[model samples]
Target: MPTNQLTAGVCSLLNEPQHTEDLLNSTPIVQILSVKKVHSNPNAPNPVDRYRIIVSDGEHFLQSMLATQLNHFVDEGKIQKNTICRLDKFTCNMVQEKRLLIVLEISVLEQCEEKIGSPAGLQIPPGDAAVTPSTANQTPAAHHTAAATGGATASTSNTTTPAARGQGARSGRGPTTFPIEGLSPYQNNWTIRARVTNKSDIRTWSNQRGEGKLFNVTFMDETGEIRGTAFNLAVDALYDKLEEGKVYYVSKAKVNLAKKQFSNVANEYELGLEKNTEIEECRDSSSFPVVRYNFIDLAKLQEMAKDSICDVIAVVKETGDATEFTSKFGRTSTKRELTVVDRSGYSVRLTLWAKNAEKFTNTDSPVVALKGVKVGDFGGRNLSMSSSSTLEINPDIPECHALRGWFDASGNSENFQSHTNSFSGAGGAATFNRSELMSIEEVKAKDLGTSDKTDFFSTRATVMHLKADNIAYPACPTQGCNKKVFDQHDGWRCEKCDRSFEKPEYRYIISMAVSDHTGQAWFQGFNELGETLFQRPANDLVAIRERDEAKFNKLVEDVNGHQFNFTCRAKQDTYNETTRVRYGVQKILPLDYAEEARHLIELLSSPWAQ
Candidate 1:
């Protein structure tokens, strides 16, 4: 073909060319240039873009072709910019100031002519050396390099090409071969250059079929990402060998539809490692990218709704006592609660029950980093922690240590408080001079209070008043409702509720008059202590008080004038729109007037306030 005729033909085929040049000396080398403008193809629905390239041969022109259909060449090592490429038969032409080219199928010349101290003028050998129609079956040297590097190699013949290996491959069928493009359909035979982003530890479970180990690992490529799992023998073979952040040429794996709700990866299907699965590490760093995240601040934790999963960084403000309880799974486990707070000006309770509690307690002033921890509520406030959640103590992350320092410097440690109340308060009290106090031995010696009004409070009292003989009958068990129960023989009646009940309740009245040098006060005890002081079972006392009022009052007065010394506390209680201060007798002692007088004198003389 004539040079101009071939150039014109190729230009017509490509629609344009940026530049064109001709060389007559030294085997008539032809050079084409000015390839700045190339329009994309509207007909190509997949890639949707096309470019026009220039081609040339020193002598005769072969044929013209479209740039979009040419194979892409990615040079590994650096190449000089605009360096002349030796073409066996090619031409550069222009359509309308745009560059166009046609490449003739020919072998690259072994030698070149010199020009300006640089190689120029592509040279071609005689007839046999030229690539004829039959020689096209020979694969290029680049194809072998690709194969050795575990990359996708183009086959010289259509029948010998490798099968596609990615998505859309039918199960049980061999791999399919396809061309490479910006976003080509993934075939079953293609090997993808991907990196191991994450790997999970192998886990085993046993059932009727058998026991086996399975673990999943996440892989990412320039094109997309997918998760793959190794089962049984694959676990032992690949679990420990797989390193994260390393690239690999992966192919021949099984592909199955993935549950969208279960995974966040972009691919609709996940990969599985089979016996014939191929994975080779890619040493090229430029082929893989790192994972990135925009972590949320710990201070924003409180603003998130309860049960919302989030990441957090906080110092351990306090550690709770480990408690063991039975779980729904029938396992007895221990757990502890820890208070964690950050600069956000709020604190949250983290329950580290069981093994976590034990492990956390061993850390020295731990600062915890939690990922995917669920916010929870305890005692009406927000809390967070998780069992399957990821937790790190004093992680290398700066936020971990920063929060620790802030918590320590802010005196947060000293302000730690329990999340729940464990004790109740006293109601009312009367003060007595120390002189009136007597020991339990003395009380037992004098036999002060009778069995009736046995309830008493006193300072310097002994266990004699606490003896079973001094206790009254039982009281109601309606939480916080401490009214005495009356026995009606058939069952019991509650004074507070004014209702009759089948079950008789127990109660004790710890009422005693305390006399101090400054003043005299009355005290009382209800519920547990009341039953204890009366020396009667709470149920029995409830029965007696309910059915036999005369007996109950007589029992109360028998201990009168006994002068049982006691101590009491006074507190305010509101009922029916009125607030009343009630007195609770704390302790009681049998009086020895002389001994009481002596103790009272000592107390009065003491420097401590009355």
Candidate 2:
């Protein structure tokens, strides 16, 4: 291609505004004159990289951005400075009074030695004077408001009326509403018209600061999404006012840096609602975009890190009855396990808690769309819903319909591979596969606990001896706070809560020496695992020890020689300037001889064994 020909169409879209739509749809070719990397937060764990590129046709160069999704082009040396490329797909947005072309898709045509023609910087008109090729139903004027205004009274030069300055006015026609993507701590005087994508129940917390209640809601617009949280009085005022899937005009809320540890929203900032925050329901919300999901397939869940949040769509293959359990803090909670499968031929367990568990009655293999569910490596790979998670049963979307059709046709007949290798026992109890069983000698030989990361493995061992000294600790009774409380004579005082409780909950911290054929080693277990081993609550055991020391000693003797399958976590721990590997029991399952024999037979019959 000639250099002059490449530069001939430079700034063509700006020069020929009348044919802008036609040119944008044609996938215009351009030359990359220069590329610069944008700086991002250094404190972020995994900050996304952004690139600003100056492109030219021949006579003029314009500023452009490479979308994050297309970062692979630059990373793989496919696209760089002085490279000619075809803009396969892109959108233009008016940001900060300038036109920014965001390239979504591109193909490198040829790599050149130098910049294409002597191209000068292209100038873009402000506000509505410049026409952009964005498909979103947003105008330059509204985008200008989003970028320029910080909540002072609207300028007289704009079309906003004086009555629009206050609350109770409709959006679009009243005050100019800003985009959620444009929200930042620097901009305070802004109103946003967004739909509630997800809402969390009001939850109370107590720390050294004091006790207070808060609720969170995720809001979305055509531009982007942001999370909003209201504390105490604001929670009481706004909790009942906001409904999931409803649109509202919100303003006067403070914006702060996002806490990435808690949220999966992509925005860099979040909203803090106050007592005087204005929130009026918007009746005209048809123009707003619906809740978006970046769904990951079940087969790929294993590649993701544990505790990461993700969205997934799968078929409910099996549902378990809800079971209630009391926490160490004496708070009762309900949870149910579900076996869900997807087209990837992988099955994973999904746990639902509280109201979500109780309300889930779908038993007809309904397709479920889950958003913001947490990934866990529990039985290999599993999912659990959090308070901010969104669950849609049989959603009237194309993805749901397609999954349903696939399941009814051939998906149901396909035998899926489960993440955990388990089978049913005689009484319908779950039996673990013996293939994962590791001998105590093999564990030590592999130096499993030598690294900083914790290692998990299963083993079958007998309880050689049980330590009966200091077996339990008095923990704070507050829900979710199992910290050990100190005795302050009058009552037990919890430093974490800065409060005193009449009676502290006794939680078990069992230490036992276990032996396999290889060797004997000591292991520790907390509350849940200790309860499973003793078959009684730690509090009851404490009472028995105080009332009848003979019976408590007898109980310990009875469980001394019992053998069972134990899943344990091993990590290097340092105590008093000494470091050693410590094994902590995670799960205790009763031994099933019948299941063990079947596993042996299956293993012997395998081709590898032969």
Candidate 3:
């Protein structure tokens, strides 16, 4: 294992059919010459970026694709130019008349400052060549290799190359099945062997076009996953034919740009099934992977943007009874909320809708695995299951088993931090972990609002003064909107909404000065923080100001000298052609002296304190 020594002739051996089996079996050391990031489709709603690296074996260099599972190595800067790595597992395939090696598993050996040796591009073999299946039934590794390499049946004889298969597929001859990862809009006559990971119930929609019934299913193979949809007659023909967790040979479907708003699959293209699309069940599906998940911890959900889709796994801590509500269109639906806690010691609320809400009855702290759940910013951070989302309770997966064991052992006794509450409260006592806590002096020293991105931090401070003038404004009353409205003598008009209202709703936009032991800074807050401070609505304060000015001033004075914990967001703001840092209140909570005392005691008892 000498440093900078590479296994030469590895790329040349990859092109030779005789060395395919041996090369696939042995791990080869190689040097990475360069790395490039490619977006599958730049126009895709949520584009998938993959890394392509050129690896050299001291003599020949070859282009390779890094599997999505190993993308973190590139993202985290572990694998880069001149880096030496050992390829533990890989598969070679010919795509678009070029050779490609898909790196499935790899280990970093060393980082080099310069290239190890002079290497030329590996020559492509003559004629249309493809890997042929062995005489034996395909093993898990062989099967995955074939899937990444594209097109091979279990039989050794009558094997077809991927290029010839594409041509044959169009000519109605002996067609070859393609892998899901290599599928694109240009290839129409392609078949794929994939398992249905999730299927949706049939639903009817009415739009500008005629109404029709449709459903969609997510398909996964060894390489990647794609979403497929069937409408009208296709729905009637294929709705019942597809089942979750079942493998099938699918062909003759249309490949088009993916509708990302309706799907969270990483693939850039989606399949459209027609009535004549061919689909058949594959009984021997031992080689296909069951499912793939990229779960985010409950605590990490706070950092993610709102409305993003993600996967999560946790144990059900508490479940609420199903509640019925009527939509604005008069359609009734049911929704249930559950509090889920993970090993990260954080809990978040998850809402289930419709049939899922009505049928959920697991009361013994079952492990819940959710995929494609939408994140929300309401009450800090929460999750809601969309129509395309999937939920599994107490699945037989290893993560579920481990979570169940932990919950049974010690989770039930541990107190969990909740996303909905600013602090963990018990018996009228609150606690702060102080992980994000900062002092006013530290906030100023860090220049929190100088950057383009907003900075969020928490501080314990007391209100010094409140500016009582122009503290409230007339705003449009539309839900989810707080645009200021203009009064035109008779009625209030909202330019953004292009509508007029009889009157306008009054909302607080108050400015206040807060101070800690170090220093003081001015902060601006909206309706929520204002109500919390005044213990009343902004409209009441407005009415009181018009009738009795003395009472309004007295109320503002009462809020002064009150101590609280504040979460604030700071960002650079441009006003009147001048840019400056603007501080806004994100959340406010009453100060908990008991928790502060406990935190101080723990800090004093630590060895570092001595």
Give the per-residue lDDT digits (tens) of candidate 3, residues 128-242. Answer: 4433444364344334333333333544654533222232111112234466766654345567778998888898877688788999998887667889999999999999999
**What are the per-residue Cα lDDT tens digits for candidate 1 across 204-271?**
77779988888777776433356788898777767766787686666777666544434434344577
The segments of candidate 1 whose C-alpha lies over 4 angstroms from its true place after superposition are 1-201, 207-212, 217-228, 243-271, 275-293, 302-308, 320-337, 351-362, 376-389, 411-610
Candidate No. with top TM-score: 3
Per-prediction TM-score to the true structure, in the order listed: 0.33, 0.57, 0.61
Which scores higher on TM-score, 2 or 3?
3
Position 29, candidate 1: lDDT:
32
The better-scoring model by lDDT among 1 and 2 is: 2
Structure candidate 3, residue pairs in collision: none
Ranking by lDDT: 3, 2, 1
Judged by lDDT against the true structure, how good is candidate 2?
0.73
